[model samples]
Target: MIRWAASLGLILAITLAAPGAHGQSPAGAYETLRLIDGVRVLMNPADHASFASSNVVIIEQADGLVVVDSGFSRADGDQIVSYIRSFTAKPVKALIYTHWHNDHHQGASQIQAAWPQVRIIATEAARRGIDGPARLEGVGYETNPAWEALLAGQLRDVAARYQEAAANPENDAWRRHRFGQAAQQSLDGIPALVGTRLTAPTELFTADLVIDDPLRPVHIRHLGRANTDGDLIVWLPNQRVVATGDIVVSPIPFGFGSYPGDWIETLGRIKALGFHVLIPGHGLPQSDSAYIDRLIAAIADIRTRVGALAAEGLTLEQVRERVDYAEQTAIFGPSPARQANFQSLWLSPMTENAYKEATGVPIVQGQGELP
Candidate 1:
């Protein structure tokens, strides 16, 4: 599912991306990183700045190419296709969606259109969730899949808001600077969203599946639920790299509708995989477990703190006030501005999610408002 994170407007940032292959493209173009011999990860340019796309991985196999996560919009899909064409002449044989979030899977139609015979793969739950209640509530998915036009029409209003914020003297220099950049990033992505259609997975599996190849075999398995009910991890065993959807994000993690305790176990499962390089859903590729460890610790801390406060009959707001994640938040960044992001983006929902898990409250799936 895509998030209108910029609407928060309090904290917007750009992640440090790996240098793009060949050379740097213009702004709004995703930066590229060649992880190994055959795999290249396209880092989202609008990350943390606006409603962004997830990192896209293109894996070259013996006969054809296999892709992980399509992108956020049709424009993203078109750009990915051009990149694929430039990288190799081989057709894309399969495209894998790690979850039901549109940011991760919304651009599938363009890729499938490029290669008509391409088999789009996802967990059976993700396939159902794509059109089912579990899918992220976005403009360009399920029945109301006109997100391109919908968002484009609303961009002017959003830009006006940014302009107003930039003019406000009360806002700090950082906010004004970030607002200008965020507005441009959102505007630049408008062309890509046009003509994009909602696409669902063509193939589904209940658990582990392997796309066998002599040079670049891909092993996919569904670890326990973390970000969503149906989460898949693509393990490139030979390369010792794993593409963990939103289950693992960098700098800040998403806590919407997440299974707190189960997410911890799921991260543990990923850690056991022993990947030399970790490709997160967003942000740059990681080679160490340091970020993962911090994520695990933060989730556990919030869940435990929330559960304990709830057991004592403390209300959600009161618990939030009482809980202190400053030490943990500082791990991602020490500045107050960065801490605000870690709090809103990660801590806030995570606390509620943990409380819900402990108190047996039903958390609604795919219910956030969209542009």
Candidate 2:
């Protein structure tokens, strides 16, 4: 059974420090926010960048420590380990994966190397999904020189945009400039993946599993499919906090291989948990349910709008044109660039997924060539 805490103040007291403070590189600097007693959130600096990183939750237990999610690459894992050691000398006893996303669990190998005895835990579905083919086709572009060159060209174009944005001196321009810098930093970390090893989960659960610790009873639950089929949310009941893997990403939600219908229901369940703090898979730690509410509303809106368009005999392309995400774009960001990014990242895929779900179209997995 899941337990709920009573009225814990959800204060957002984040302490952003440079990685150099801990002898790490500036590019690897992460924001460490103490959510509550014995619970901290380590958020990657390049969060807004593409394939940037995931937010890692650290729970200091009685015996050692429990890590909610590993990060994007081996270097990210090393940075996480160093950050943990800065304050506590306790060994990481268990590494709990929120989902099977490469950005979330790929760093498990580094954690394992640091502590060989650490038990890696994930849902049974996630365990299988990890070893499966890449979620989106043509995603592994690191191995292809042509793809790499294409990405490099795109990066250069973005750099040019950043330079233009930097001269504007507006808040939006500043935000764009920062995002460009972060994206460059994230790109720089790609070389670390050359020899990085991705470790699989040593322990798997079907429904729910508790990390039977007297001091901190960590409850891991699979609340239907949201981000992926194996999505898991780590509930720290005592601390009134929940680590909502990719289920509740901020700025904009990711819909690749997502179940839009089930995702809304899952968000409801998360809200029912009454968590004071939400540690999302990406972005910063949220103190209120506003962001989650927005995510739920967005998914619900897509299902309704897209379903209506499909029912009206409109094709996928037609539906995409008809369904204007004006509201979502306004809330997430109103800029043309932000709107385009959001549409490409979430809206486009979501529309197609929602249409498939509405029209009873089968989802074709592993159809395209691997990049």
Candidate 3:
């Protein structure tokens, strides 16, 4: 999803998933996936219902729990707090953000409320973005009323689109009604997001930061730029579990303002980590490099294609029309919903960033997108 696209911005993350549900979804709001003895990922929040959030991971050390990706809204954080309380009474020691995307870090306030002493950590660059002016009137959206109104309005607009589609004889009646219901489901989440405070990470490191433990040691590394300028991946050597923020999202990836070559190399480095269990920012837990390998190939394919197309002097939109990775739809579920997700969330933005790389255009954060 383009995190800060000009017209729609983060709203696309939800609306684009129209018929507003995951094609292959977790039955509950969030599922607990036990990687080893102490590692758990509170999987996808099917219960959130509106905006999509990154998967919140819980890693247990001897004394306390270490969490990755606090989630999108405070309500999401509340669900996470309840989810954690349902399992254990261990105090949360640290809340780590993989990147600065709103879906990954906006819920920090709720977690902070739960564990007042929880150390919120991010890479130096990510820390800047935690409080960066991503959207709205030159400020982050969580605290921006206009941005929130714009988002709610966009979802409403989508609902109207579906409603109109339902009445049209040209579109499928069943599809329209199904999608309309989904749009409404997303709109139902408006109240939960108001007055969200964008809590910035407290601690920062440029390269590596470690939270040492006898049982489960966390080795946090900023492995180049992938999903964002400062992307953090948590590696627990003892447990053999690695938490990849948005650097690796299962189901489908988000390519907004991502670095194509850097992302490919970063994933390659992640593949070399020899992790027994990989918890992506969203979706289910991964066991091997199969998904990582596929992601690498998919990205390389787009980079190569876009580089070649741009060499021919075609504009980004022209390149977009000429480029097609629909074959990847087979790799990430060929359902209509999945296809839309793959193209919009991953393909479109990946091609744009790769084009910038090839043409020597600066891909500024929150700038290379729809504005």
- For all predicted structures, in order, the TM-scores are 0.87, 0.79, 0.86
The residue-by-residue lDDT of candidate 1 on 58-140, one tens digit each, is 99998999999987777788889999998689999999999877678768878888999999899987776567532344543
Residue pairs with colliding backbones in model 2 are none
RMSD of each: 3.8, 8.4, 3.7
Candidate 2 lDDT, 79-180, residue by residue in tens = 888888899889999999887666677677778888999999999888766665332324341234443343345435444554554455563654555545
Model 1, C-alpha of 367: deviation from truth (Å)? 3.5
Q: RMSD (Cα, Å) of candidate 3?
A: 3.7
Q: Residue 355's C-alpha lDDT in candidate 2?
A: 93
The residue-level lDDT of candidate 3 at 211 comes to 92
Per-residue lDDT of 281 in model 1: 84
Off by over 4 Å in 2: 1-25, 46-50, 134-183, 335-337, 364-371
Stretch of 10 with least lDDT, candidate 1: 10-19
Best by lDDT: 1
**Which runs of model 3 end up more than 4 angstroms from their true locations?**
1-28, 45-49, 134-178, 324-326, 368-371
Q: Which prediction has the highest TM-score against the true structure?
A: 1
Q: After superposition, how far is residue 324 of candidate 3 from its true place, in Å?
A: 4.1
